[model samples]
Every structure is written in structure tokens, then in C-alpha cells.
Target: MTARKIIHIDMDAFYASVEQRDNPQLWGKPVIVAWRGNRSVVCAASYEARKFGVRSAMPAVRAGHLCPNAIFLPPDFPRYRAVSRQVREIFQHDTDLIEPLSLDEAYLDVTENKTGLPTATQVARTIREQIRS
Candidate 1:
């Protein structure tokens, strides 16, 4: 296989996941990361909220209307950045060719991974497991 080995890691609804991770009460519930205002747009929405049509970049007012029960919270960039850095560090263990798309997503070129993983899938899975731990 001559194709380059690349892995795209995206933390689904990272802001919402962080909220859920930090606050047990938010787990298994609709979480919307946005301010409470018509001008505000949703930064991220949990799967629970997505089921109700909530999404990133959607108007907060619409998000509220779509998921009235959703827990709306303001964006916390500093906290998310810290978490992102930790995630990036995990990627560093495998490869240094990381192209960060956002706080939660990155493109990793693991063609010649430092960890000696035979396949990109294994590298991705290992990074995921590290994040979980």
C-alpha cells in the first residue's frame, strides 16, 4: 500500500463532552455550549442535543427552541485549550506530524510513527485509549 497513512481524530462535540466529563450531571443529557442570547451561536452540542436538531454554529435561540431541555453553557476556551494540549501530547507520542484543525480535531501523518505501530488504526486506537485513561 503506497497510500500515506493518516488519521483524523475528532472529539465529537468536544465542548459538550468536556462539560459532561467535568460535570456528571451533564452526562446522558442534552448539552449546548453557548451563551443565552439571540446573537449567540452554539459552539458545540452533545449527541443528546443533536437529536433535537441542535448543532454547532446554529443560532442559540434556535438551539433553545429545538431542545428546550438542553443545558446551555458559555464557552470556556482556556479549559478546552488545556485539554487540547494534553490531547496533542498524546499524538506527539506517536508522531510529530500533527495538523491541528481545532481544539478537538487533528490530522496526523503516521506513515512512520515513532511508537512502531504497524497500522494507522492501531495508532489511533492507542491514542484513544490513552485519552480515556
Candidate 2:
């Protein structure tokens, strides 16, 4: 059987990363993007905030306690959706076999990619580098 090459990419703390990317002030800060309410849950926590044990699905108040210095911001779904589209477009450029798990994650089947890369790992690395750039 022929090998079916697959590549998975997941953006770290997607919402928080978008926030930080768009706002210089948020860069390097522990950020938690979620709703604001007594019963609210975290949506995304930046790596900086994760250092203090903050995580998604955790209660907002608990996350605050875990990272006292963490900055809480409400999620902007529209903005996230827009960015997700952009990422999808990037994937579409290489292959049509893209499956998105979420706005920040996806699987790409690149066994026969347009770029003619030698290996799936190379394709994955290129895609990641493109996203990072």
C-alpha cells in the first residue's frame, strides 16, 4: 500500500496569539481570551499564562488565581474567523485535501503536493514557517 502523508498544524493559544499579534502591548504578556462572567470559561490561554497553570475550559476566576498577572480579554469570534479563513487559504494553495479541526488546527494531506517537496515533514515545516511569517 502507498503511504498516505498527513500533516497536522495547531496554532498555540490561537485567540490569544491573534490578540498579541495585533497588539504590541499584548506581546510577552500572559493573556487569557475568554468571556467575562461568574460562570464564564476560558477559551484560550497564552503560553505565558499557561506557565502559571491557566488553561482553556477552566473557570475564569480560577484562571485568574492561577495567573494573577494574566490579562483577560473577551473573545472576538469574527476576527478569529477572518484569520481562520486566511490560514485556510494558505493551506488551499498547496492542496485541496485540507481538513480543519478548528480555527487554529488542521490536517493537510500532502503526499502529492503542488510544491513538489520531497517529504511530508518538509511540507509541514514549510506550512508552519509560512504561518509564522
Candidate 3:
């Protein structure tokens, strides 16, 4: 039997991060990705907003009260999907054994990687740099 080396990538607050990246003004400010309504749920919240206890699946109304000054924007799914595809492309540069969990998360089996990175951590680190670049 052979051991497997796998790396899990979860981009926390992905939607909120994208929002901040796309709009420079939102950077460093609390960001909550949700519509403004009692019934709407939070899709994502930035670390800034998380400081106020906001979280994914949380009620938008509650998140609003938690961080009143937080930038609230409905999710931009199309843009997120595009970025997801790009991220997948970066993974392919290292390995083909990718198991996508969502637009912001995935698992990559790099036991026999294309990059010959020698270690799973190195492969993962390079992948992270590629995604950020």
C-alpha cells in the first residue's frame, strides 16, 4: 500500500475577500456579503466583520447589527466563478488530482505531483503563491 499526500485549501471569507480586492476602498474595512434583509443569510464575512461575530449562514439582519458599518454587498457569483476557474488552473500546474469542494475550497492529492515539488507542503505553498499572483 502507498501513502497519500493531500492538501486541503479553504479560502476563508472568500466572497468578502473578493469584494475587497475588487474594490480597493473596501480593503481593511469590515465586509459582509449578504443582501440587506431579515430573511437573507450571510454568504461570507471578512475577518474584519468576523470580529463582530458575523459568519457564513448567519442572518443578514443579525450581521448588520453586529457590524453596522460593514460593507454589505450581494454576492457576485459570476466573478467568483471566474476566479474559481483560475484557481483550478493554478492547481493543475502542480497536480491533476483535484477534488473541488466549492468555489473557495478544494483538496489536491499531490503524492505524485506534476511539479516534482518533493513535498506536499512545498506544492501547496507554491499553489498558494500562484493563486495570489
The CA lDDT at 85 in model 3 is: 93
Residue 114 lDDT (model 2): 87
Q: What are the per-residue Cα lDDT tens digits for candidate 1 across 1-133?
A: 7788999999999989999999998889999999999799999999999999898999999999999999999999999999999999999999999999999999999999999989999999999999988
Candidate 1's C-alpha runs over 4 A off are: none
Error of 1 at 98 (Å): 0.8
**lDDT score for candidate 3 against the true structure:** 0.93
Against the correct fold, how does model 1 do in TM-score? Answer: 0.95
Report backbone clashes per prediction. Answer: 0, 0, 0
Tally clashes: model 2.
Answer: 0
Query: What is the Å distance of residue 3 in model 2 from its true position?
Result: 0.7
Taken over the whole model, the C-alpha lDDT of each candidate is 0.95, 0.92, 0.93
lDDT of 3 by residue, 46-91 (tens): 9999999999999999999889998899989999999899889999
lDDT of 2 by residue, 18-122 (tens): 999999999999999988778999999999999999989999999998999899999999999999999898888778999899999999999889899989988
Q: What is the C-alpha RMSD of each candidate to the true structure, in Å?
A: 1.3, 0.9, 0.8
Better of 1 and 2 by lDDT: 1
What's each prediction's TM-score?
0.95, 0.96, 0.97
